[model samples]
Target: MLRYYGVDLLDLHRGTLSARRVLVLIRHLPRDSALVRALHGEEADWGAVEHLLAAVVDHLAIGNWLFTSAHGDSEPPRPEPVPRPGDAREEETAATPSPRELAAFFGGL
Candidate 1:
């Protein structure tokens, strides 16, 4: 399954839209995988990049169902809490999307 690594949005000037670069990483692909050809960007706009990332995240979450039998589990493992920076006590829940949402997301694709 694909995992969310992180995204970095960079530009020459802060808060400016000119010459921005968006780099995204989703784990599990080999270094020489042809999938990189589709994901690599040269001068793509922010909106398109954001949409692609969203679609990818949704796809991975839903695609896990295909391997449920092999895993011998009906439910996926619960995600661990992500600690917030500068606040040791603060944590964020990483909830998996509902089945209905996954259905809709895949249907649209």
Candidate 2:
């Protein structure tokens, strides 16, 4: 639909939508969608923002299942460990820049 890929996608990409609004839209977006692919690309990782949003989404889903589906009688599932940047197991591990490189990139020591 135009609303999904056009208007809502633009608002999300521009950060013009609220966190909750963005989350809802993001949930409905297929992983193959352009917006999802762009936001979650290897060349353009928004590190902390991505992690926090993922945690919120995961916890929300778990909470909903626990409360509504399980009738508040079951213990919630344990949270998944946060992903480490540059982990050796990653599909594309990142190398830490040297001090000199960092200084050069930052324009100072």
Candidate 3:
């Protein structure tokens, strides 16, 4: 979530990302954001970006799915991430965000 959302998982794990500014960053990812550009724009390094960000792309998909399901809102269709060779399915999400910290995310509002 760093590139697009500007809040790293580490911050979330540390119970920091829910701060008002950070939550604003995460919730306000614009359509023309850099992550969207890399995903849909004429990216030059399919090989490198795919290898480096394959997991990130998957997480984006999952996050989008979760958001849509939770809110019951249909977002605009976006292209699926390119499948990686062998599809490294190692354990991701090592540092799940603290629910208690997230509780404060909305409190600042």
Clashing residue pairs, backbone N/CA/C < 3 A, model 1: none
Ranking by lDDT: 2, 3, 1
Candidate 1: Cα lDDT at 11: 28
Give the local distance difference test score of model 3: 0.62
lDDT agreement of model 2 with the native: 0.64
Query: What C-alpha lDDT values do all the predictions have?
Result: 0.46, 0.64, 0.62
Q: Which residue runs does candidate 1 get wrong by more than 4 Å? A: 1-46, 77-109
TM-score versus the correct structure, for each prediction: 0.24, 0.27, 0.27
Candidate 1 — what's its lDDT? 0.46
CA shift of 31, model 3, Å: 34
- Expressed as tens digits, the lDDT of each residue in 19-69 for candidate 2 is 787677667876556776677665235456787887888787767766765
Tell me how far candidate 2 lies from the true structure as C-alpha RMSD in angstroms. 15.5
lDDT of 1 at 26: 31
Off by over 4 Å in 3: 1-49, 73-81, 87-109
After aligning candidate 2 to the native by TM-score, how far in Å is the CA of 35 from where it should be? 22
Best by lDDT: 2
Clash statistics: count for each candidate: 0, 0, 0
